[model samples]
Target: MNSTLSNNPAVVIGIDLAKTHCDVVGYDKNQKIVLKLPRISKEKLLERLTNMPRATVLMEACGGSHSFIRKVKALGHDGRLVNPGDVKRIRCGHQKNNMLDAAYIAWAWYIPGISFVAPKTQAQQDLQSLQRIYQGYMKTRIEFGNRIHALLLEYGLSSPQTSRFIAEQLPEFIETHTKDLTPLAEEALLMLRDSWLEASEWEKKAGQKYDELVRANEDSKRLMTIPGIGPKCAGALLTHCGEASRFRDSRQFAASLGLVPRQNSTGDRDTLGHITKRGPKHPRSMLVQGASALMIMADRLEGALGEWVRKIKASGKKYGVKVCAIAAKLALFCDTKDPTRTVNKKPTSAVTKVSGIFG
Candidate 1:
């Protein structure tokens, strides 16, 4: 410990959480640095924190940070997680190191109006873990499918569009094309097909796991009530957002997930660009993919949501633009509807308002 001269106990401490070690900095009530310990081993760090007087512990919300926060809570300290991006904006100079990052994290808390991230409960993290596993399986399935498609393309044989269809038709197609494909291509195709089959099966199981998680979670169930938002989308949204109360309103929630447009506005003029795309990629993807489903069948949809979708289509925007428009609207709708799954029961006004702008 690079302990300072003052004897008063620290009232605030910032920790730069690394995988195996952490850099820690502390400040007393008088805004004086009281403690500085760089590259402390994880075990010794916990012991140090446990012995210290109760103080607000700050750390960037990174990998393992939440679990560390839980441990700190067990030791009877007030633990807070700050966004790493926020810390960067407040950080001093271009120079960076573990100690500097720790000091910045602590000072970031001292700065007024800096927001804090809500620490996810163990249960939320568990659900999110399952969702992440599902994402991995899906990615594997897609990757293998693409490889299969490319391989078949090389042999002048078209693959079936869907994974299940491809799995079923592959053998017959291979037999029929035996005269065309080289032995090496046949061997490669067979190997890729088996991998794709394994991945597709795992993907289905992962989806089933998602359904199991959704069934157990009231929030996920409520979210699934919206058309085109299945267990997968519901799971992704909950995994990313955690809770609706974390946000002030639907727009803020949407903006938090980067569903809103970027702005480069001057006093005299306002300009907006593409979506910021600033948060977790998976949830935003689920929203837009679900919106594509709704857009393709918008005519069959009814009520305010349908009307909004239809009007957006009527505006002659491209499919991609329409899907994003609907996704943003859907994000807003999801925020207003979840947690209690009450209040803002009808999305008519929100739907009409956003549709009018985009349409």
Candidate 2:
């Protein structure tokens, strides 16, 4: 095993974390082991780190790391969450153990080009909780729609399979067929009707809160200014990313969200793969949905690039390619840019106009 942790001057800590316990390996700049400690309480971990002169703490980005990271920040020390996948790829030998893993995490942080995940704050936690609830309600609404459609198909009665249309016709359809329907079919219809009403109520409640959240935040407003970002998308993104400046660029932000495609190539050969969706699933999903919305309402986006995208779609390329392009563009749009390279432009007549649309 590597034994250089003790002698070096600048100390770095690697923590292999678990639910009830965590292992810490302390190393010096020369890679000598200064300390190899067993499972310790998070409270004690903070106390010990706080007592030290100052050092960098590194751990894998997992569920428990967030709170510890917040504590570490309060102690006036840097806390880095090394992506586990990146760490696995960096190990040089077959002798893998907890101590080596921790040390490697610290080493990875010191290396250039490897990215770290930003810790979420209390505000972000709260926002995520609310968004999850909203998403749950939306899922119920979709299930209710499916049930209603299925029930209608059983009878010779059918209308459009959209939420709005089904909701609008439910009451009238039920009233007209009340006497003609059999008892079992009527029971099923009644259940579907109740579910539909409940789903509508849930949607309204979630929508109201979502709108209020978007309106109350400056970051959400800033995100909304981008083409295709709506209230739900903006609110979710602003809440999830707590600190936009932490991302070095938009591409990093997009990559963090798993928007960029993965690539594996060889000499004189190339292979581009699907997006390595290895980050937070919710926000990445929200951004992709927002990108789809932007693609549909292309006229709302103000830029030559957005206009060009519309032209490509108009030229009869597949809709999927157009969607992927827009999602990639969205990643760039969210990034901070050099003022000299940025310009203002308007949407062209290539796309249909859409009202109340945001980037």
lDDT of 2 by residue, 185-230 (tens): 8778768768877977987897788788677876666566656667
Model 2 misplaced regions, further than 4 Å: 1-10, 87-107, 110-112, 147-160, 164-196, 240-242, 269-278, 298-306, 340-359
lDDT value, residue 267 of candidate 1? 92
Model 1 residue pairs with clashes? none
Model 1 regions lying over 4 Å from their true place: 1-5, 155-158, 334-359
Residue range 93-174, candidate 1, lDDT tens digits: 5689998888889998778888888788887798788887877988988888888888888778776778666688887888
- TM-score between model 2 and native: 0.75
Consecutive 10-residue window with the lowest summed lDDT within model 2: 350-359
